[model samples]
Target: MPFYDYECAECGVFTALRPMAASAEPCDCPDCGTSAPRVILRTPNFALMEPGMRAAHATNERSTVSPKSTQAGHGPGCSCCSAKPSSRTLTRPDGSKAFPTARPWMVSH
Candidate 1:
């Protein structure tokens, strides 16, 4: 089941709920019993891999490398052209590096 976040306009309170598909049509605030607006909430997620799992997966994928690399068109020896490097290094305008990887692709604006 998926959890949904809702906020009550009458009482200005937020709550989470797991409702049946039909029940979600007219969800009511638990506090004031008024209709609450459903809001999308971000939830954290993770995948656990045992030792050597990552390496094993990478090894298997490399066996079928194409004759021409997909990134070859970008540039020779370019970071983006290298087998989609394991991770990206970011440098700020001030010439200082931060975080191991580039900013997430889907960050909220």
Candidate 2:
């Protein structure tokens, strides 16, 4: 059985479950019992994104440097890209730091 949508003059809109062969047949409005003709409806388009994927997409959108901007050297004394992306001055305590590569003490390589 396939679901069908119908419009009734006195009852607005209603749904019905019917065979494909009888999908085009008239439907009775549940409230008014009036015979109403079936109507064609457009299917809905939906996107289901995982939490991590959605978060990553949002982060990418809000990135400080865009592909075009970074390629043209948006920062001072830099073009295309630099060996270093961010600089850190550790006057305060912050765990977030960037190095070109991990040191021997940081990880065994």
Q: Which pairs of residues collide in model 2?
A: none
lDDT of 1 at 79: 77
**Candidate 1 off by > 4 Å:** 20-24, 47-109
Clashes of each: 0, 0
lDDT of 1 at 27: 66
- Clash-forming residue pairs, model 1: none
The deviation in Å at residue 11 for candidate 1 is: 2.1
Q: Estimate the overall C-alpha local distance difference test score of candidate 2.
A: 0.71
Sliding window of 10 residues with minimal summed lDDT for model 2: 88-97
Model 2 bad stretches (over 4 Å): 44-109
Maximum-TM-score candidate: 2
